[model samples]
Target: MFPKIHALCAAAACAVAASPAALAQQTLPAITITADPRADRGALTVPDTEQAIADIERIPGGVEVVPDTQFKNTPAQTVKDILERVPGVFAQPRYGDDARVSIRGSGLSRNYGNRGINMSMDGIPINTSDGLVDLFEIDPTAYRYVEVYKGANALRYGANSLGGAINFVTPTGRDAAPFEGRLDIGSFGYRKAQASTGAAGGPWDYFLTASAQSVDGYRDHSDGKEQRASGNLGYRFSADAETRFYLNLNRIRQRLPGEVTKDAALNTPQAADAEFERLDQQRNIDSLRLANKTMLRFGPATLEFGLFGVHRHVMHPIYQWLDYRVQDYGGFVRATDRRMIGGFHNEFAAGVKVHNGAIDTDQYINLTGGHKGNLAASMYDTSKNLSAYFENSFFIRPDLALVAGGQFQHAVREREDRYLSDGDQSGRRRYDNFSPKIGVLWDLDPDWQAYANISRSAEAPTFDANTFATPTSSDIEAQTATTYEVGTRGRRPGFTWDVSLYHARIENELQCLTTAPWSPCTIVNAGRTVHQGIELGAEFAVLESALATGDRVWFNANYAYNDFRFDGDPVYGDNRLPGVPVHILRAEVLYKLPGGFYAGPNVEWMPKSYYVDNANTETVDPYALLNFRVGLAPAKQGWTGYIEGRNLTDRRYIANAAAAGVATPASALFNPGSGRSIYAGARYTW
Candidate 1:
């Protein structure tokens, strides 16, 4: 089936390439950066994060960027899929769109919530006061670019923590244009509509966007819907100074029918059992953000400062059995200075942040005598954190640069738990650490560069990890790591490629341990781990031929290899990292035909391995799948249509796994990736 689909797509692309209209559109345009907060000479070309990326790559670490064009090509539904395509980055999705991301083996023990990685949108931190972010709450369509800085390079953000940082940047008024909107409907009763408009008049500029999406889900009992709105307003005070205000709000409602057994997941990926009727769950997340940024020019130097605040609320009822509520509020401020010293240019950035939050939960059980009662298990945690960091990138020579930075963080966490008629259990913890990074970049030539660096970072425990009493410590101490890396990037006439290799050693690594009964467990920092890997990515215009009607053809591919493991640990016993695939490869060949016709076929392969279930039992498997798409658009004013088919092979495979000793016997939460599904849609843009 895969081969047949590939062949059909290939033939159609070939025919389109041979048409007369495609030849006129064969010439590819240079990429542009559209997400920067400041408007300057470089705004039309290099991205604001480009300097950040260069500094990170040169630091003894690894980093990657997924531009807007690359993300759009895949039609990504979630941030997880976007990260998986980046070299050396892994995303473990235990359920729909809820992801646990790890880079350089920094977040191996994150099972139930986000840890290690620090995620942010437009410079506003996303992690709760307890140091976790629910990735599902993010709307992928809202961001124009994503910057992933791994290892010590993340020190600039005061996130000297493990797993590094991910910055999602939204479009500014200048990039979005006057007005635009999109509407799409697809399989599983999926529907989505979004619109944005921005205008610049005099010294004031404003942009606003709203979007909504709903899906019946691929499996029984799993349906979801979401709505989001965001706006930005900026004013220029002077020729070189401007201030911008931002606002964002989101709401999500979902139903969890419950997980299926392994056999059921494999045999009937689309079927829902009758017993699932009794299972019901819903989650709601509401978030509000406000921020301001200003840029000032003094002499030959440019000074920038930003202040922001975030408030998030989570209300959830799981299985009608467990109810949970959480609220988080936080704020931060950052400042940076860019200037030329003597013959060298330098950029220095620093910031401080703090957060406070609380969580409360209740559990219920069905009594054997047909009686049902709820048990109160309430907990309150207050956390205050402060970090100050400075990063400087100095151009020692026209083609040579040196980068160095460090951060000092002070964090305190206090928690109190109250059980039904039981005395309160209270704990308080404090942590202070200094993280530093240094790197060098030698631009050997115009299109080629060599870089190297070494850096130190840390990761804190999550709320789940904080629940434990002993051995877990109060804050799980900070998980620390040292990373050494080198890499290169270049672009030739028809080829563009980037590759890097890194080695990292982590101490006090976090891992989950299951007790004998397997009904309850705790997270602890009890082990050491090592990660080494090579990431290679490239795109080549395999075939660029002009045919009738201005058609063109091209093919591209990317691959990544990761070697991660526990360093002679007693408990894990030579087990591979649970969610990180040793190898990942993606390839596609596309052609633009005349008369607005396009077609392509792509393949993604992951050789899987075993993962410890919630009960500490191992489950093993390996799988492969293929996908294809073709679309047509009549040459008209503003109307276009497209048809896409995913998982063309209809292969049955698990998309994610649960924590050790979490699921019942014979019950593994095997969230299957979508099967051979098809979607057709149309849009009108003016």
Candidate 2:
């Protein structure tokens, strides 16, 4: 957390006047977290929009910073709740808060456990070294802001995955309210309660948040519960140096409703597979993470370094009683210099990151009543990655800058089979790649900017992607892509817009093929594929003077046009990729008042039917959903309340589908969407 400018200056003065020993021994006074009273007024919470967006725009590609105000007052339980309006981000809720989250179709083929997209909490990596992220481990209420770096824009963080990175930043003592509490109750036996607090004293600051939630899902055998907590402690050793430690824990238990046929999904939306109920199929996880970060400032440069460790245990029963324990640790260091070079402005940055992890896995046959039958097999899997990167921005003109950078990565994947019955199916592989990026940014004016960039990215196979019947590790190749993008973002008066066009040529694409729902999806390689999309977002005030002062109507909308297809494949030549829709659009008409009353009607429409297999024989129907929300948030000293209704038309739709290798209806690939439901919540702050 950063204090007000005055308080920071005062602390800096004291530090400069005192000797090192004296400063270390001094007892400082308590400091309240608040914005600088002397600064110009702006939107509440988070950094000022212009400055923050400027920081994001420096990446020269698709990037955004979504503030908490966008979805905080609603049922902020799922990533889809907030990400639905972000262009290029395709996230749909699965049974619970678990989502099929993908970026530009990066992980479209994955149905369970996340991949392609790197995830972080407050600048600390949350994804395992093997490129797997679990959405259930994240507590929606734990974050105050979310920073999205799409595609190669994430090179600064050593993220080479196709989807780039998502950083959920926590509130610090200087930014959070002293204490806050919230409770939410909704349809289908949903309930949630969360509490958070923050405090700062002398050189010490601390912030903590805890939440518990449960839901009897719309479909039978889909109930789930989760508990999560996160906190951070910080110390400012001097005006130019500071360090922070972060801790996070999660315990999650979720049931699997199992997929059904399209007819059964629409006719009996609440039905669950009988076998799933009999077997009591479920996925449960317990994970803990600890991390530390330190920042030190020199004359014209700053240095940041950090270390992190994680311990995770998973007890799940899907095709089999899967038990896995993961231990991962990593560290990173980064240096940044923002200074003038030979009469021109220059921003230079460089970093090195190392991450390694090992997994101890065991499987057993599922008997019944939460019991494991015979031992199936056992294996030990490990992964390690080391990367170095550098980037620099050179001002060619007062309003233009040229950026060039690249990263070199060395990684290894190994598996040791311990079960003799498995015939010693063990292997090891090494992957190395050098990705490069170059871009240019021109400040069209103070209110807008135009940018363009080209970059290369690479991703290695994960343990989950190695679910071959033979368990051979070297069978799959790393996925690679080369992308070219151009974009423009601008703000004028009461209107703002962000638009970009991008195309990527991918090789050795990791494609998933499944024959039956009873089995895990199989990973295979597709020859060459092309992914191109139009990502657009715009919002503007529609009415102001017609209503009361400071009261207005706004129109917000986001549209994504996906054109992903196979490039001259031998079998599925020129066929569109299965899974994601061809086009997705979301729009909202919102009315707001100065006293904090707001109401909006929103719609989500999938205009193009998408295929369910490479053969393109079967396809999911196109559908649209109508939703509405109303809320009241007076101020920090009062109660805030909201009412949200989703799928108000009670549309019988299939929200997502799992693709199969062989085209057939009996694949049990369709997951039904929830019917009409209403949710209400309230919160208090002091």
Candidate 3:
């Protein structure tokens, strides 16, 4: 089916490219940025490469952007599926909808909550100071594009700058138009529906979108349902200045299919039976964001300023797993000034941020004879940061350009925790740190560039680790990393590619320790670790025709090699990082057909290593998977349908590993991936 789809799409793309009408429609008008609405009138079109370069130049380190065109028509189910195709990025799915993301060797020690990286949507930080970002709260359908900035490049966002940053940007009223809707259904009882509408009248423009999705799931106890709504209201004072307000709401109801043992995972990756009563989990999140951006022309310089705030609330029902509630409110103000000085173009930016939040969590412990012990934990944390940064680009002999920049930041954090057990309260803890970064880029020519940078980043300790009066103290020091990276991006007539190499050394990393076999796990501060790797990615146009109506064929691939290990004495041996796959590779080929048909085939491969059990036992082997998709558009501006198959080989495997011997000894240490599944869906756009 996938091969047929690809052949169809390839034929369509070639036919369109060859058609005189299609060639005529391919020409786009230039866009102008201005302060007057009248002056902003024109077709707003910009190449993906231009935006990618702009992001790279503005950031202090490595950065990558994935355009909407890359995944809009793919058979991907979640953001993890999209990101996994990118080199140096990996998603670790615990069970069903829960997943943890890691980049360039970072997030190796984080067991429960998000750590080492910052995630944001439209400039609102999704990661709490305690180092956790709930990936389940995000829906990929809402965003027009995704951007990833690695190492020090994330400094502009906030702390936890070491691993990197991910930003999801939604489409505006002007980009998506008046109304749009889509419905999708796939294998395993999967179904999704989404709709959005927007109107632009004079100076005011409003947009709203809603979505609902459900799946029977690949494994038992993994089935789930989700609903989400988002809105954006903006007032354009002028073309150069605008104020926008955003609101996001999400609810997820799911069942926890506890982890299985290595044997179970390997033998029955799609099994749903549970030894104990199945646990049900539900999560709710409501977030509001307001931001204002203004651009001003000052003599030979352009000045831009932005101010924004966010409010987030989360509730869950899994005490031992993660039954907690939190409220976060914060604001940031930043200004960037760009000007030409002494034949060099210089850009300077400075900002200050304040974050204050409170979290209350409860833990239940099962005692003998079905008795239960309840523990209540509460915490208050506040963080303030001040930073100043500058970057300069000098054009040397037209064909060659040099870019350089630096940043200085000062941060302070304070925390206090109270525990109900023993009616004890932990004293307030205070911490402060200073971090810096520097980088340089050289454009060898129009199609080639070389860049290198070394930056420092840090992450604060979380409340659970700090408040619980366990033998292992939670007063862990902040973790820091110094990373050096070199990379390049370019394109030829029929091919494009990007590659990078990086090395990082971290201090005082946080490692979670679980009680062997019968006991639960806890968070702890480990000594030191080192992460180094190489990433290579590229895309090529395999076939093209100008005489046909719409016929084209393309291939895309990504590969990464990661080498991670302990740098100093730590509780655990210098074992290869548990979840970080040493080698990851992905490739796909897509084609468009003349009759508006499309098809594609994609493959993902990962070499596995030791799977750690609660008793520290190891499960060793490797895994590979394949997927295929086929689709057709009955009319140019009407209905489109698709059919997709996942795990075509029906190979069974484990997606996660943890200690689970005592409770469900036979299946306590593994979480299986999925099996071969088929799905079909259709959409109508007007």
Candidate 4:
């Protein structure tokens, strides 16, 4: 099915490329349009946060921008903490920074690190060459804002993964405060200190931040500490060209708390497995990254290109002792022409990127903690990726446009076994995929827009996903999907909403099959599956009475209705794939008190229990959590403070579960959520 459709798209793209109309249009008179590249949407803008949100509303599809202020004044701990209340995003933390963050059911089968999702730092890919990405490298407070490109909307960022991409944009010296400092103390022995400085002189500018944090965690054997520093220096060559260099360094040391059974997870939620406690397993990392981005504008056209390098060292002791040193390098180039063509409005963008890396990896028997017994396995692993993509939108009218885009990706994975004493698992795999997308955006008026699109996405199995215990059965098939979606976004009379409905037909979903205890799981090419859902985000000015000139009450909400199931699989036979709940909702209500004081209550509710495995033999019950926060706005005074309370009801519930093929109900699969906690933070600005 995909082959035929892809062929059609390829032919159409060729035709469009050679069309006389397009050629003539491009040869037309070129007019230059220039403006500041900063996120600020000058003139027609409100506050910074509002401007960010407004930018998202202008996109034709599912996309969003989260303001830094939303979490900076609060206890910004982990990805889960940073992405709360964002619909279509499921970020559930089990321990420390290990969270299950999936969008649109992508990476639902992985209980560990992320996959099927592309992550970026200032538009640079954050995933390893083989798709091994660590959330701990992401400092929740380091970003000025976060941009979410859902699914195919990620074309601009060079991502074609099923889960799309997330870009963390940092603040620069242009408008940042000269100096800022913040301190946070919270329950579970949590504490952090952060400071940042920004300066600009002539054509040179720099922004830098340093942060240190530690947490005792809510569970036994779970403790962690991290130190991070990030900086960027920029130089402007005249007004039409600019270049920036970035540097980031991070060091993290975190313990591991093995999973517990359902009963234990709900009862003794704070207990760790006896084996994990004795081993004192830990995951530690030291990493350094450098990157650059350059943008040049020329008469209604722009060119952007960049290069990046990352060096990371990891020492982990869990099921086995592991050590790794990885070096990754990449570069990209993109060009955009937004001028009118053939007297009609047209926008075209094209780009290509290449990323390659190798890792020196070794595994040893865990003698307990950091001690290694003997060489168990050793290998040199390498991964390479190359992608070419293009997008062009033709305005059919002044208020509507038709968009076409696609990406071609080639990926290679290879392993060289050095430990023949155990077994020679050396092999290689190559994968190629062509993902294409088409859509239409129509303006209903000046304040509203409607859009519909269909796209194809593919995912190659990652090294972690191919960790087969049996070397003979190491080949895992890639996953593919065809998705159909429609959505709308608009604002009217103090109200804003973004909603979308989507359905996907998926083939060869990669699934984990744990056949033995104390052994690494193997990946399988699971049969057909279907993913369907609705995503809704809304904000309402509930109380804007004129009587209270300065007081206002606003409510914000995000909800997702997910229905994922097997599509006539031989074993599961239409049973729902386990892990994600049927309904997830997050909401908040805030009242502004004229004096720069604001208070809000937030709720995260999963109204339905979900199965834990393919067999659906066991389930996790529904849960609801309430949290409250009161804070003084940063603009209110030189010194501002906030107090936040989480899980006020202290409800016991499972936060995440590990899935097996169809194991016994007694398997250790559950991880408990954190208990009641309180955090207070203060910031000083000059």
Candidate 5:
């Protein structure tokens, strides 16, 4: 087990650093892990959260583990609500469950849907085979903990995207409570409820959870409702062997307000776009996932394998009516060995993954009230991907280790157009690439460490870009980048910090460059670009007990500095990237009593406005938000509750913006943030 950060438990300190929402409530005393009965469970198939954190620390780059306890008191409804405290991550909600998320400048060109990143659950890919993520499928309350691997550090998962990967780990019956329930209600007619139960008996374990939520949204035409269910069953043949099965289902419906002009976004922030309201735009989806995994231990080595399948149906109405059905299946195998090699401590791991999927797609003319008219397009799309990766860490001395790894991937994309009206836009493309990484880690002490790494990343275009961006050609190339990074993390008596600096040189970067109104922007490959930034996360204990009342004061902050630009293009020259700002800062100060009650105020600030067009002719104005929370955190066993307020100042600011080649003041490209609101919740467990 890792050493404790202070008088508090290592688990509490690490969890606090990962989520600012938990910073002020650190009143739990340190406890020894050996006395815990759950420690003897199978580590390979289902390691506890502390073990997960220790494993993540072995990686020589940016990574974090966030326990669900850290955000339990808040309205854990969206990714932004749970992940916003992690440095180097950008998550801004547009409306309902949809958010524009990116890491270290990844997916800057994508305004809707996810790209340049990989998302998984229990090591199984949640993204479609062609690399698209639907945020609506994730239920924040279902995860036991979340693991974030930024950039090339995600080699363990065979991820090749520049943004790396995030894995949501679920609890097993051996570690969960027998029964748990929660309810949350907030402004704008928001409501959510969840129930879960788990148990273990005679080498058999099971866990199940279900949730339902609805929101009348702060924006017109943006209301949504969703339902989710997840469960897992595990069987142990012996102390060293186990197998588990998982099932997940989701039903979601969300109305789209669409984008608004800067003036409308800042002035009439609550109004929906006229065209979108007239057309009654909406998105609805039904999806199911099933998987099985097995693990076996062999003294000095462990082997794991798994297979997963997903089925989804989507109905979307915007400019047109889109109906699609997708079926995806894949499998992975991995092995890890730890032992002494030539009298030196060494650890090695290797894995291979294969993912394939097919989609039946249809588009029809749109009628009023989100009804379908005549058929506009029909196609069958298929994707195949295969990747193999390996990593090794060799200890040179008691306090130093050298790490090296690499991944090779082959991918194929094929589209068969069945509709003749669009003149058969069928096409085929293949991509192959190898990425390598090298790093050095030095332990300054038990509580501090420093590391440096150089790595490469590559990403292939998804079907979204392959189909809509190029109607008559199939020439878009893969995006690739080489990056150099260095960082340090440590904890002292009263402070903890994690910081990293990185610079990347990219080639054939994917970008959307179009100025047409009411049409999809065309994605293209840029000649060259650069992404560089600093990520900083820190927390400090301000006053231990100034009033002699056993109360404490804490301060927590996260700051990201981004500098992204095109190297030199004939049309745009060396202009700044359009989507993200240069500086983002979030900070909070809180007062806590020894009994678990805490109160705090926080702020989110963008110091300067950023451009919205590649030409740098138009910009989105900078803004700041003020919020506060007061809650009694959950203890060993009992009922807990919290009240939270957001945007207390009712600031009218742009929350998200899309990229364009050139734009005017009239361009409808910005999404407004929600106004002042309040939320409250209660939970009980036994």
Candidate 6:
């Protein structure tokens, strides 16, 4: 089915390459138009956080811009901390920096690494060409802000996945402190430190930062350490042209505690799977990336282009000792035009991305203490993908707009099995799709808006999902869905709110269901499924001038309701999906006094239990966690301190679980949550 479609796409590409219309469009002049006049248009090549937020709010769907200031006063250790207030995003830590992050129930099948979502740093792809993400390599302290585009609204980034896209924007010399240092210490032998410096002079500007952390995790056999460094250099040729070069490096080592039974998870929360300790399971990675971005402003449009390359090496030891070396490279070009068309306000954005990568894998029998005994298998895998996307907004009325967009993507997956002992498992697959979107936006007032959109999304299976017993799982196919969404967001004098409701009808949904304990899961295609949910985010000023002249009481909360289940399937009819909880709520209240001081209490509650298998026989329990924190806001040139306590009640509960086809009580599928702990930190800038 995909090969035929891909052939048509190839023909279309060739025809467009030789068309006169394409040539005429390329000759048009470039113009610079911005929604915010305060945006820096001269020296900086990228918009600042404030300008970015202002621009993102114009989207006709779910989108968020999270600034680093929201988490700088607390323990900014993981994605969970940085995205805590963002609705529809579920990020939970398993141990150390390793986490299970999903959006709108996307990637709920795979238990390791990240899938179903596109991750980027500084507008460059961070995931491999095969769509696998190494979460441990992401350093939370290195970013100035993050942008999240939910579902098909991420067409601007050429992402056509169910979960959409996340971009981490780094700080520039102009916005960064000249010199800064920070230190953090916490329970369970956790410690971290960071240092940074930035400077701009004449036409040259630079920013550099490095961080290191170590943790003896809450569970046994879950100790880990990591170090990272990132920097960028920018050069300005004129007021309308600029170029920047970036470098990033990471070294990580983590111990795998493995999953435990439901009984052990709730009773002996600190216990590690016995097999994991005996085999000394662990994962270590070394990676480096180099990238370059340039911006050119012509007469009426803005053109941006960039290229990047990454090298990653992994050493993983579990039931089998796996060694992998990967190389990936990509390039992208984007254009934006904001001008009057037919005397109506119009905006158009278009982009194309090309990514290719290869991986060399070797597997061996695991010996005690993470040593290799005998060679088990060897294989080589390669992937290539191309994506082109465009979006246009045309004002039909003074306060109303119609938005349209689509993405065309093509991909090729191939594998070569060097070890013939594994039945010569070699194959190739081709996949392609054209996803379309249409939406409407109405500006209710100067500070409020309402939006509705109907869109389609598609995702091809990654190599990890395809390779268990063969080079490619013939039964595993691409997942596709059509979604309908409606939402409203606004900000009043003392209140802010963002709410969205969505429903998706999916076909051939990919799922990973293991059959045995501690066995690798095999990816399969589910016949049909339905995913529907609601996302809510709100903040209120409970009281102003409660204690002092410039003090206030603030209440902030976010909620997500997931209703995912099979739809008239031949087997497991109408059974709910097993990975995510039915309902999740997070809320906090803080009191601010004089002198940049604030204190807050927060709660994370999951009131309903969920199943862990397609049969819906085994279930996880529900629980709530209480936490508190007090801190002094960071000053430009002085020291600030903060202290936080989490899980004050020490509730024992399951944090994460892997799915299974049919589960028994003895099935080892649960990961325990952390116990009570306290953390403290200090920072200084000069």
Q: Model 2: per-residue lDDT, tens digit, 557-664?
A: 889999999999998889988889999999888777667777879999998899888888878899999999888876656688899999999999999888776567
Total clashes in model 3, counting residue pairs 3 or more apart in sequence or in different chains? 40
Number of the predicted model whose lDDT against the real structure is largest: 5
lDDT of 5 by residue, 168-248 (tens): 888899888999899999998899999999999988999999999999999999999999999999998877788999999
State which candidate has the highest TM-score. 5
lDDT of 3: 0.59
lDDT of each: 0.62, 0.79, 0.59, 0.77, 0.83, 0.82
Candidate that beats the other on TM-score, 3 or 5, i.e. the better one = 5
Cα lDDT of model 4 overall? Answer: 0.77
RMSD of each candidate relative to the true structure: 5.9, 8.3, 5.5, 8.7, 3.8, 9.6
Tell me which residue pairs clash in candidate 2: none
List ranges where model 1 is wrong by over 4 Å.
1-37, 41-61, 73-75, 92-96, 257-261, 271-279, 319-327, 360-375, 468-475, 512-521, 546-551, 593-597, 608-610, 613-617, 631-641, 661-669
State in Å the error of residue 491, model 2: 1.1
lDDT of 1: 0.62
Ranking by lDDT: 5, 6, 2, 4, 1, 3
Alpha-carbon RMSD, candidate 1: 5.9
How many times do residue backbones clash in model 2? 0
What TM-score fits each model?
A: 0.85, 0.92, 0.84, 0.92, 0.95, 0.94
| lDDT for each residue of candidate 1 in 201-304, tens digit (9 for 90 to 100) | 77777778888888887777667778888887878776666777878888877655444566777788766543444434445677777776666655444555
Per-residue lDDT for 1-686 in model 4, tens only? 00111111111001111122222232111112123233233111111333444434434678777656566777888987667656788889978766888888887766567877889988898899887678998988888777787787888877877788887877777756799899999999999999999887877878899999999999999999999999888887856677889999999999988777888899899998777877778889999999999877776677889999999999988778889899999999999787677777887889999989999988988886558878888988888999899988888787787889999989888888888876677788888999999998887766567889999888888876554336546678778888898998765555557788989899888776555554455667778999899989876567753346646676778899989999998888999887788899988887765556777798999999988889988888899999998877636238878899999999999987777778576777788999999999988878
Please provide, for model 3 over 96-214, each residue's C-alpha lDDT reduced to its tens digit, 9 standing for 90 to 100.
Answer: 45776778856554444456677887766766645567777777777666777777777666544567788776666655547667787777778888888877788777778888988
lDDT of 6 by residue, 456-503 (tens): 999988886666354346547889999999998865555567899999
Alpha carbon lDDT of residue 181, candidate 1?
65
Which residue pairs in candidate 5 have backbone atoms (N, alpha carbon, C) closer than 3 angstroms, thus clashing?
none
